[model samples]
Target: MSRFIPLSVPNLKGKELEYVTKVVETEWVSTGGGYINEFEKNIAGYLKIEKGVACQSGTAGLHLALKLSGVKYGDEVIVPTLTFIAAVNPVRYLGAEPVFMDCDDTLNMDLDKLEEFCRKECTLTNDGLINNKTGKAIRTLVIVHIFGNMANMERLIDIAEEYKLKVVEDSTEALGTYSTEGRYKGKFAGTIGDFGVYSFNGNKIITTGGGGMLVAKDKNLIDKAKYLSTQAKDDELYYIHDEVGFNYRMTNLQAALGVAQLEQLEGFIKIKMENYNLYKEEIDKIEGISILDFNKNTRANHWFYSLLIDEEKYGLSRDELLNKLNENKIQTRPIWGLIHEQKPYRNNQAHKIEKANYYIDRILNIPCSTSLAKEEAKYVCDILRELER
Candidate 1:
């Protein structure tokens, strides 16, 4: 393995150059361009949503969604501790706090504990669901589909409705995931919630250099999110501003790349799924480690493949294997540290985060780029087997 296998990287072997060239030729490379609108439409159409609004990044889209979800100052949002911090930071951006929730076997928000928290720890009032611990309104829940795997949306949504909590689906890692057997069958990850957001970062399933899209069940919310992303211009002709807004508009260049990337998205997903299955087969031959599968009820995009390592059985610790693989020119990364354990969020309320802590130290993300070659994957597995020996 002379070449280093990257954990993840964008696959841009399509009309990306052509589309970006068109944007440059038409001099529409800024925020305004035909490609931006088309990209939004293509994304919305793919997800079977009414509309999609492009923003500078997923974090910005989440911030706008949190604002629209009516998470006012002092409001509380139930978030997952096992996910990237971006999923919970938007709550702070809106002057609200986040009550961190634990992860289940799927590495998603534990719906059982979530229900328990609502039933035993909180009370529903006229204002909203009030958290008895903080005496603040529980206004929303941010559900992140970890590693392109769809969470148990069927149960999560029921709990949300029963508790009157607005749902925001952080589908940043799950753009192509959709339910197959449920009431929301055929509903995409982002479309099932009140608001869903997708990331087009360089390392995501797709890339637009760096950008995101926001979709919602209601047209007005999507429209307003679009407006707020572009500085909330009430009257464009006179440049009149109506409210505090963010300059979070995605560039025409990025959207140009996005449209081209979206065209190849399904094909990319196919390759990713195939590679994931291949890895699963090879890794299963080894002892003390296993590749975790996605929820069988949904079709996942397979953005990342997580390896569960049992140190005693594997003969090597997770950190030891990580270092060995990287030294052998294979890139691997540990799962994110629990959000509640981070310094900035340590003092925030965290509810029974047991499984998250357990998996955080054992889960390792191996190379899973859409463009990863079969030989490279085999090379990666060969190294793992060597470590086991």
Candidate 2:
């Protein structure tokens, strides 16, 4: 109880050091090395996907995905206002606009709203789905599997097909999440869409310090992504460039960490699932706070846990509880401010954001780190229980 319980932290007890030491000894610490290729292949194999391209970060992967999806200047991309800003910023990176959609109870894009927006507010043309208001093509749909919970992809995919929108699954927070039934049964979060991206940030279920992976249904596109990531070398020996490229390749050092971290990914997910159940069982019994649940049809990675608080019942506002938790040395954070309301995005179109607004004010993220001890979780619950009185 004396030590601060972080909201999320990397579980590096695996062979991270040994693998990184090997990379250091080999002197191939930059982008080109065996670790990079091994990490990409391992991730693609884990997801049961055809190929994966390693890159610098999830944001970079998204930018590349959008570019590969044919998003261009003056185009628009459908996105979720309830997700982290990284998911939306990539659209702007391509000089495209974003149409922010609301979130369902799962804190994922509301497929109902997305379908309605496409059917009622846009027109499908030979070019693609065109926004009635802007008259620009809606080229892509970026779906973020928020907090490792799979969005209703079965329904979303149909909507995209009908509207002619290319789908990009922003699976940054859902590395191991997958559907257990229906069409996408056994398909991992990042594998079901036209393109999918994974992050290896310090706080994710697995960590490569700072790196990401991109997967696509088409093998050729995967090859293109790799070329674009590594400076678009037309002829590597001559450094001939046929087009614009980015210095976004993942370093061998990071990939070494990723290879080791991935080996323990399933184990990390197991611990996360168990801890989530423990938190839910105890927290649900409290007067005004309860743990958020993932979709029933998917096996989520349980990356982060959400605590919904009712101010009238809990006798404290969400901010009040956040401050109290900080005072008690129990680290907690509020859900992200709706992206639509942020200063830079205030003018962007956000459709029917009722539930997202409601959830934003009530949701708090508590300590759910993979390294978190059971006793530490118990201590957190005890504090919340005591606060109820």
Candidate 3:
């Protein structure tokens, strides 16, 4: 059997080893070192954001964003249910609840339903913020940029502003993606909203082994996130503590790898886009499968290539196709199961999940690793062709 094509994986060819080796040689491996500082600067410089906070994981970044958004114990946060639960779980971490919204064709937050849900399920207070029917202030909106394709940021931001809500961008899947046309022109995914979070997990466009970055337009917010991530320590040298804080700092070793990975991110993104194009070209001809597309106005990172299976036309269920691919060692998988349906969040608020269901049932993620060579792409395509037959 051929080597199994993975859905996503890290590609570290440049200075990953050299930087990690330097960290080891220098013995600053635990945390807080030159590499962490350099990695933060590199991220801020790359995205041109006001500031960035390096954290231990993307979920940690989200937790900080939620806290910065003023999400308290009794608050409600509007979140898309179609995304990875990590995007919504942070709400729970803050003792807040998530009011789940549906996704549009872009597999992003459905703007129309988002508006309607806010309108129907909420009432505007004198401050112009939407309050849930139960009167929990809908204080923030968490928008996940699923698969490196953006949510309707223009409309979502407008909604957020009108409702006096904070916007937390879960750009964990959208590191290098941006809007080509908008009020936030040329702004990167995580930078457009009130707060943005990114992941550098093993499967992301770039990997820091285990790291993520948080960005914001406000310096105070960035500082606060950094403070919160560092376990809210009052004094560093004296070990004085005024408030609770977490050890969510990304280590120097991770940051060293991040610095190298950031340098190669654009090139990695190119490979993702190219592989997506080839997948479209190869799979569009197969019956019962439709290539997923991004919104025309935006330039996506093309991080994940999705094929929506039309069971009616293709004459096979999505799981059946998934099983077939797995049996053939192609390593394809489904889009995330809706967050609302997850075991932990099964009882959360959900509004108009029709389109999200439509998407989740049919989408298949092909091998989208940057390191996946052209021959691998051909092999996966051939297996897909065989599956269609």
Candidate 4:
């Protein structure tokens, strides 16, 4: 059997072992250690944000952001229906409901639909943005940069400002993505919002086994996040508690791995872009299938390469292609199901969900591991072409 080519996996070619070994040797494997601080500092520097608070997972970071943003029980948050359900689950964790929005061609949140929903369906008063249907205050907007492609942040920010909504960016898949043109030019994805969350999951562009980070423009928010993540201890000596908190701090061992992984992030992203381009070049020659392009206005991380399949033009269906590729020792996957269609979100309110449903069926994610060689990428494209024929 041929070696199985994964859809996406971590590339640990840097000092991962050295840093992890040091943590074990020093017996500092818990949350407190030098590596934790170093990892937080380095990631904040990379994004040029004020500060970063290391957390257990991206979901935890999102929960912290939602809590800090004061998303109460009766509030509603705007979220994309095409993203991973994790993005919407955090809103539920805070006893709030998610108002599902549609996706544009880029598979990010549709700014036009978002604006239309706010302008036509919602009424903005001095109290806050209120949904006419549910009669709930829309307190926040959680924007996920899907597949490392940035959403229309420039217009999204303006809409959020006009409607008085706090913006929490779910940048788990868009660590290296940044704007190259417009008013917020040169700003990273997460930093442009009120609070940004990053993931270092095993399949992410970078990995720390299972960890994440939180960042904000204000240093105070970052500090408060750190304090809240560490169990909200007001007095450590007496173990005095102020309010509710969580044990969501990233462990020292995880931070040790994160520091090393972050060191190679730029290089990994470069390889990802190159590999995506190679796939695009070969697949473009075939009829009925094409690789989607990132927003030209942004320096996208190019984390995941999605193949848009036209079943009528192409001989095989998307599912057939996915099955054939897996049978041949290549891993591929379809996009996530629409969030509003999920069981938990079935009762939730969805606004103008047209494009998201359209793309969900036609999109197939191909092999995009950073360690994928040029020949391997070509091989995947060649197989795809053959399948198309």
Model 2 residue 110 CA deviation (Å) reads 0.8
Q: What is the lDDT of every predicted structure here?
A: 0.93, 0.93, 0.86, 0.92
What are the runs in model 3 whose C-alpha is more than 4 Å off?
127-132
lDDT of 4: 0.92
TM, every model: 0.99, 0.99, 0.97, 0.99
Where's the lowest-lDDT run of ten residues in candidate 2?
42-51
lDDT of 2 by residue, 1-389 (tens): 78989999888898999999998999999988999999998998899876799999999999999999999998999999998999999888889999999999999999999999998999989988999988988989999998999999999899989999899999999999999999889999989889999999999999999999999998899999999999999999999999999999999999999999999999999999999999998998899999999999999999999999999998889999999999989999999989999998999888998999999999999998989899999999999998985
lDDT of 1 by residue, 254-295 (tens): 999999999999999999999999999999999999999999
Q: Could you tell me how far off, in angstroms, the CA of residue 345 lies in candidate 1 after the best superposition?
A: 0.9
Q: How much is the lDDT of residue 47 in candidate 2?
A: 90
Model 3: lDDT of residue 363: 90
Query: On residues 1-389, what C-alpha lDDT tens digit does candidate 3 reach at each position?
Result: 46877788788889899999999999999877899999999899989865689999999999988998788897888888888878988888889988899888888888998888777778888755555556778889999888998877888888888778889999998999988886877888999888999999999999998888988878998998888788788988988888788888999999999999999988988888888888788878888887889877778898888888889878778899999888877788888888899888788778878998888888988888998888888888787777664
TM match of model 1 to true structure: 0.99
Residues 247-338 of candidate 4: C-alpha lDDT, one tens digit per residue: 99999999999999998989998999899888888888999999999999999999999999999998888899999999888999999999
Which prediction has more favorable TM-score, 3 or 4? Answer: 4
Model 4 C-alpha RMSD vs. true structure (Å) is: 0.9
Flag the better candidate by lDDT, 1 or 3: 1
